[model samples]
Structures are given as C-alpha cells and as structure tokens.
Target: MIRGVLALIPDEFRRFTPRYLALVVLLALSQAAAYLLSVPVLQALFDGNYGDAWRWTSWLAVAVAATAVFGYLQSMVGLRIGVGMLRSVQTRLGDHLSTLPLGWFGTTGSGAISRIIVGNVREILGVFSHLLSPVLNAVLVPIVVAVGILFVDWRVSVAMLISLPLLLVVNRLANVGYSRSNQRIHDAASEANSRVVEFAQAQPVLRAFGATGAGNKALDGALRRQQKASTDAVFASVPGLMVFALCVHAVFLLLVYVVIGRATGGDLSIASAIALIAVSSRFIEPLNQAAQLSNALRSAGSAAQRINTFLAERELAEATAPVQLSEPSIVFDDVAFGYSEDEPLITGASFEVSAGTTTAIVGPSGSGKTTLLRLASRYYDVDSGSISVGGHDVRQQPSETLLGQVSLVFQDVYLFNQTIEENVRLGRPDATADEVRRAGEMARVDEIVERLPDGWATVVGEGGASLSGGERQRISIARALLKDAPIVLLDEATSALDPHSEAVVVRGIHELTRDKTVVVVAHRLSTIAHADQILFVDAGRIVERGTHDELLEQGGRYAAFWGERSRATGWHLAPSTYRSDLNGALGG
Candidate 1:
C-alpha cells in the first residue's frame, strides 16, 4: 500500500509543478514554526513565565493561519489534478472502446465496462486524494521534527525511531489483508452493476411475462452479495488498526518515561525535557495519519487493477495511410463469419452488387441476412475471405472512406435526444436546413412535421421514444436520404411502418437507389419484386438466386417462402373481404 501511494506521485505530481513546490516550502515553514512554538511554551513553563507563554501562543496562531492557506491551495490543486487525470483516462478509454471489434461488445457485458470506467475511476481518485497528501506530510514532517529532537537530545530521537519498525509491520499486515478483500468487493460490485443494467433493459419483456417481481428479487440478491463483500473488506481493516494503535501508545509512553527519568537524574534540563515531550506529541499525529491512509491506498490498488484491465483491451485496427473511395461496389468473395467460434452464422457466402444496381437478400429468421449486411458496412469483419469496396479491400480501407460510401438504415432506429432537424442532420452534419427539409419531404415525413407541435425543432426523447414507430422509421429514412451515400444497406428499414408508410418509405428508398448500389435485407416479398437480383439464404448458405419471376419458376426455397407469406397476407382476396377475414381470425 505504501508503494502504491508513492507510485502516484510521479504521474499525479508532474502537473501543478510550481504550486507543488510552493506547497512544500509552506509545509516546511509551518513545521519549523511548530517546533519553535513548542520551545517557547516549554521554556516559559520551566521558568514559570506566563507572559512569555502567551507570546509563543500568538506565534502558534500565525503558524496555523499560514498552514490553513496552504491547506486550501493543496485541496484546490488536488481537485484540478484528479479531474484532469480522469478526463485523460476517459478519452483514452473511449478511443480504445471504439477500436475494439464489435463482437467484443456482445461478449463483454456493458455493466462491467461501466463499473471499470465510472465506479472504479471514482475509487481511484478517492484513494489518491485521501492517502497521498497525508503520506507526503507524514514522511517529510517527521524527518524535520526528528532532526529537531536530536538537537535537543539524541536519546529522545532514538527512542522515537525505535517504534518505526512496529508501525511499518502493522501497516503491511493491514494492507495485505485489506487488499485481498477489496479485490473481491470491487469484482462483486461490477457484477452487480452489470446485472442491474441487464435487468432494467429486459424489464418490458419481464413485465409482459408477469415476472417483474422475480427479476427484482434476483437483482436484490446480487446487491446483497456486493454489500457482503464490501462489509467484509471494512472488517478486515480493524485488526491492523488495533496493532497500529498499540504501537503508537507504547511509543508515546516510552518517550514520556525516558524524559522524566533523565530529568530526575539531573542529566536533562527541565526546559529541554518539557520541550521534548511537546514535540513527541506533535510527531505522533502524522504517523497515525499514515496508518489511516494505508487503508485507503489498499482499496485504491484494487480499483486501479480493474481500470488497467479495461485500458488493456485491444482497440480497433486503424490505418496510418488512409485511402479515400472513388466508387462503392461491395464484393464479398467466399466470406465466412461467426460471432462465436462454435456457431457459424455465415459460411462460404459469395455475392456481388455493382455500383448502380439493387440486390435483395431474402431468408428465414437467423439465416445470416442481417449478418451479411453488417459485414458490408464493416460493423464486423468477415471471419475468412475478403470484402472490397471499389478496388481496395474493406479491411485496408480507412474508416472515413468506408463511411463516406455507406449509409445504413435498420429496423431499430436510434435518434439522439435532440431536435428533429438535428437528428436528421447527423448523416451529413453540414447539411442546410433546406436540405434537411427536402430529405424529410422525400422520406414522406412532411405529414409528421405538419402534425407535430414544434415540427423540425421539437426535441426527441432518448432513442426517439416520443415518436411513434412509423414516425421514427420515416426519420431514419430522412437521415439516409440526407447522407446520400452511394452504397445504402437497408435492413428491414420499413419493418415498423404501416402499409401506407411502408409504401412511401420503400418509394423513397427506390428513388434513392436509382443510381447507387443497394443491398437490402427485405422482410416483405412485395418490397423486392423489382429488385435486380435476389439471394435466398438458408443455414448460412445461399441456396438459390434469380429475379422474382425466375425464382417462382424455379419452385425452390424462395417459392415455398413466397407461398407461405402470400397465404398469410391473403392478398388474393378483395380488400374489404380480406379485412373481414383478418377480423374473423382475431375474433373481432
């Protein structure tokens, strides 16, 4: 624990260079004043000079005032240092997280990362601020006082130094035990936080199942475990404190006894003996502070371990010499991928979409349709084989260049907590208000603005919770339209829309794709009837490929799926009759 406290000095003290040096001078001056004040007070007592004692008492007051000023400066400096270091840590952490492969997010829980970045960082700062200042004062002030003690009498100084080994042993024992407990407590707390996040995110589903209470109870259990671990750590520190207190008391007693014995023998002057006792009392204070700070240091070490673990994570591969794209032609050559090693999501999938054509992917659920689209956008790299945009391999292409050619619209749309216009402007931050309005008009979102109380400037709640699903879908399309990237990956982009809204959005998509390469994961067969090509996937393999009419003629997996969906839609019936049939099925 002492070693850790010492380690923070280089990283933390390098900042505030001038202020730190000033603080040191001020601390030394205050310690000297304290020693002198004790001398005058003791001398007055020995000679029964009450007037002289009061004069020295006034000097003590001045010393205290100076110390207070330095103390305030120390606090301000510590805060500035801690906050700056924290910001540095956060920036580096964010950059590292962005570089990490997408698969890491799914496997490594969000709660764990939150604990390391937020909770553990707080602990680290607490440890540094609470322990470091006192540790510095403890080592420095004691040496100055010890030198003064030696000038008064070498025997007194030796008496004080004898107790040092005992204090060191107590601190070491306490730190060893507390460190182990702190490590467990921190780990348990991280797990508990992660569970709470998971539970909250899953609450809607849990409520639907009437299992909300069960989830709450499970969370409570996790919290209980975390509390138990923390309590155990606090308890582990008690035994060390007991040993420390015993040593401090023994040292104080030893000093007083030796001084009285020497004075009785007439070997020590009464004035000097009195001063030595006063100085011994002052010296004990920082040693006690050192003991307390040792506990804080131990806990901080645990938190630091967690923070270092997070920082060590692999970052995303970055290109030093980035090349820009001149075209957007996504080609997948024998691509294979899986989120985990045991379950292959895409296997030997091969396809191509030229720079100005639309390709539709149709498949049953879990058939790698979305995975393929994600690969095209480089959300996750292909496990084996190559994906190239234009002539450069996607892996070698810079992120900036790839993003310039790609715009993604998916079923799950996310809008920042901002105005409608601002959300749409994310795709092209430099887009003008007129450009934004035009994109909204093309995405069929004009009606939505006309109905809204604030139109474009209205605030959207987090994730656009204030908007209806169809409205959110339209806004997502507007964003894509505004981006106007050459390659648009549409993954069930209209899944949340009603039939009319779906028609409008699909029309907007078609218009947008007119002279661009589009790869779509189409859920509704009606949306892809005119697509230039269709790939039917099953069990991570492309089973068939052709135009809609041609696939129907083939009568393979595509035909069977089309038939099932057609029966479900009951499109053959007249509009009114189909509504009646749907009502009958629902018992309306």
Candidate 2:
C-alpha cells in the first residue's frame, strides 16, 4: 500500500525534498513519543506505585495532547499535498481528454469517465491518508513495547516476536481475497452507474415504447449484482479477523506462561510479572492495528489500480514544436480515416475551403459528410495525408491555437442547467451580458428569450429539455456567433427547425458566415444553393464538385441527388410527427 502511495506522487514533489523530509521527521517523533509514554504508563500501574502512576498519567496526558496536535498538523499537511496532487491530476486529465480523438468519445461513454474524475479521485484521497499514518505508528509502537517486555523478561518478548510473522502471513493472504472481492464490487458499481445513465438517457424512448418493466428489471439486476458483491466482500474479511483474534489469544497465553514460569523459579517478582504481562499487551497493540489497516489498505489499493488505469490512457500525439497561424484557408490533401479497423469512413478525400466563402458538402446518409466536417475541425487526425488549417499542418499546430480559430454548430445541441445568458456566454465566458444579448439577437434567440418567463436569465433545463429543438439549436448558434472565430463549421444546423424557424436560422448563418470560411454539412441541398462551391460525396469519395448550376449542367451524382430530392418535395410524416411531439416548440 505504501509503495502504491509513493508511486503516485509526481516528480515535482520528489525533486523538492525538504518538505517531505520534514513530514517524515514529524511522523517518526510523534510515533516514538507515543510508544515510550504508553509503555511507562503500563509499567507504573503494574508496580502499584501510586505517586509514579500519577506521574506517568500526567506524562501520558501530555503525550496524548502532543499526539493530537501533531496529528492535526499532519492531516493539514496531507490535505495540502492531496489538493496539490489532485489539482495536477485534474489538469492533466482535462488536457488529455480534450486532445483525445473525437471518435474515442463515441466508443467510450462520457458518464463512465465522469465517474472516474469525481468518484475515483475521492477514493484515492482516502487511500493516501489511511495508508500513511498507520504504517509509521504500527511499525514504531510494537518495537517500543517489545523493549519494555525485554526489560521485564526477554523470553516473553522472543515468544511474541516468533508468532508475529505467522500472523502477518495470514493477514496478507486475507488481503488478497479482500482485494479480489473489492475488484468485483467496484466493477459492479461502474456497471450500475453506466446502466443508470443509459436508462435515464433513453427514458423518453423507453416510456413511449412502454418498456418501463424492462427498464426496472435491468435496474433490479444491477442492484442484485451490487448486493452480491457487497456480501462477498464482507465474507472475505471474516477469515482475517479470525486469524487476528487467534494471534492475540496465542500472544496472551505466551505472556502468562512465561511470567508464571519465571516467578515459580524465583527469578521474577510478582510485581515484575504483572508489569511484564501488562506491557506485553501494549507490544501487541500495534500489531492488532496493523492487521486492521491491512484490510483498509487492500480496499484502497484496488481503488488506486482503477484510477491508475484511467490515468494511463494514451492521449493523442502532437508535434514537439508548433507554428503560428497566418492564413485562414483549410486544405485536406488526400485524407483518409476510419472509425474502426473494419469500417473505413473516408477514403482518399480531398477538399479546400477559401477564406470568406461557404463550401457545402452534400451526400447520401453514411457518405462521410459528417466525418469530413469532423476532419475540418481537427477532431480526428487524418489516417493518411495532411489537413492544413491556416497553412499549418493540423497535427503540427497546438490544439488550443487550432481550435481558437474555428467555431462549430451542429444539429444536436447541449446546454448546461444554467441561466440562458450563461449558456450563451459559454463560448466567450468573459463576454458581458450586453455582449451575450447581441450574439443572441444575431442567432434570432433574443426574440425567443423575450417570450420566455425570465428572459435571458431563465434557467434552461438540463440538456435544454425545457426548450424546443429549434430553440436549443438557436442557442447553439448564438454560442457560435459569440465565439467570433474566423472559421465556422455547421453540421445540419437547421435540420431540426420548422420551415419558418429554418429560414430564421439559415438567414442568421448567412450573415454569420459573411466574413468567415464556412463549411456546411448539407442535408438539404436547397439550403446551400448559393454556396461558392459544392462537393457531392458517395462511398467516402467526392464524386462530383462544382457550383450548383455547374453541377446541374454536368448531370453527375450531384444532379442525381438533386433529382431524388426534387421528387420528394413534400414534407415527410416522421419529421411532422417529431415536430408535433415537440409541441410547436419556438424553434421547431
């Protein structure tokens, strides 16, 4: 357990040695003083020296007081150290998470990682405190107690020492069982958390499908697993306690026998025999505490392993040195990517978006339109070839600088449970309320907020459930506008809006993209009729490219798509059903 603890402290702490050296000094002194004072208290009581007993009592009182003060200081020091360590961990985790390829999130649930940050970190803190102090106290206290026993009669001390290793071996074996049990318990716990999140996220669909019983049954199974794991963990500890109890009994017998034999041989006095027995108990006290600590240590060690595993995940690589941005155009040169080894999504793709122009990408579903947009944003590095944003290779530019130049608005929008203005202000957190209001106006969100009960300060529900689909999308656009980046990427931003709301948002995008390099993932080709360039993708390749009229003249894949779209001019029932379900949402 101690080895696990030492391994986690970063090199910064290791390099600066004075602070840790002082902590070690304080811990050693405190443990030694506590042990010496405790042994004398036992000796005075056994000798029946009333005056000496009173003297030792006063000394023990002082020792206890000193221990309390030292313990508090030690705790405060540990807390400071823990906070520093935790800060380092959180910063590193956040940085790594942000740089990880976008596809990683699709494969890994966000909730599980959230639990690692919040829950696993708390467990790690408790582990550090539990493992450190007990180890020093346990080691020092027994040695002091054994010396006092030796002064009375060396035979008793030797007998006690002989049995100590056997108890340690038994306790270690018990620790292994407990550790395995905790691993199962924690695994069950993570599954329960993941299931609850999944169930909650799908509540609307499940309720509509009338699968509440199935959901309940899933939760019940999770609960059953949790209960079983907890029961097994408790069961695993039973053997450890039994072993500790037996060891204590054996030590007690050895003390009594050694004292009686010496007294009968006229080699020990009655008072000395009693003192020796009393002191022997103190000698074993530290061992008993050590036995109990081993249990906590094992539990903590299991938690640490989980936390370490999470921290060990490899983050996306970046160049050792990065260059500055000097241009605003984006170029993809023979780029290729895949979500998995078996499913290639984009192959040998190439495109370019000039500054201050809107480039539309239109394709059938699963033609890599969205994947192409993700590449433009550097959410995933290309599997081959190069993506250059502002003339610097995307992977060779620092992530912060690359992301600072682009703002993305997508169909599915998320808002935190905060005031409307605050959610909009997230793009530029330092923006004033008046500035946020201006951006909201540009996104046509100000009009919606005016009708909301509390206006801009109104609290949006979690993930914006309190608002309409169109309303959420508008807020997302407002956030993007607030960012004021030179580049904007839109992924079917108006796909969720009613015709009226769609016009409003599309007009807003038109104005917002005026001075920016715009890349639009085109689901409705009509929306991008005025785009400076059009790229029609099929089977992960750009099958045609030209202006809207030019593509129509060519009569290629773009013309075929346009023909299919023209044939389906009327509204689809599913969209109408979805809008009806939204209850005439302001943006829907």
Q: For each candidate, how many residue pairs have backbone atoms clashing (under 3 Å)?
A: 2, 1
Q: Report the number of the highest-TM-score candidate.
A: 2
Expressed as tens digits, the lDDT of each residue in 1-588 for candidate 2 is 555655566566554334543654566455545555655666677777778878877877776677677667666666666666576666766766776787888876655677666666666565445555665566555555555566656887777667666666766776677777877887677777877776776777779977675557776797689889989988888887777778777877877888889988999877666666666666677677777777776666665666676667766676767676776888989998998878888888888898888899998888999888888878887788899889888888777788888998877789999988999999999998888989999989988988988998899877886887888888888898899999988887666669988887877776677789989988676665888999999899998998999999998888888888877866466977787878877555
lDDT tens digits by residue: candidate 1, 1-588:
434423334355555745754685576568656765787788887889999989888888888887888777776776666666566666667777887788889877766788777876676666434556676677667667766677677887787776665667767875677777877776688779887876766666778877565547767777888999988877888887877877888888898999988888897888978887888888778888888877776666666766666767765566667775666788889999999989999999888887887889998998989889888878887779988887678789778888788888888898888999999899899999899999999887888889889988889877886887778888888898999998989987666578887788777777667688889998776666878899999989999998999999999999998898888876466889999999999999
Q: Candidate 1, 464: how far from true, in Å?
A: 1.9
Lowest-scoring 10 consecutive residues by lDDT in candidate 2?
Answer: 15-24
RMSD after CA superposition, every candidate: 4.5, 5.2
- Provide the overall lDDT of each model, using Cα atoms, as 2-decimal numbers: 0.78, 0.76
Model 2 misplaced stretches (Cα beyond 4 Å): 7-65, 83-88, 128-131, 198-203, 212-214, 318-326, 341-343, 549-557, 571-588
- Collision count of model 2: 1
At residue 333, candidate 1 shows an lDDT of 96
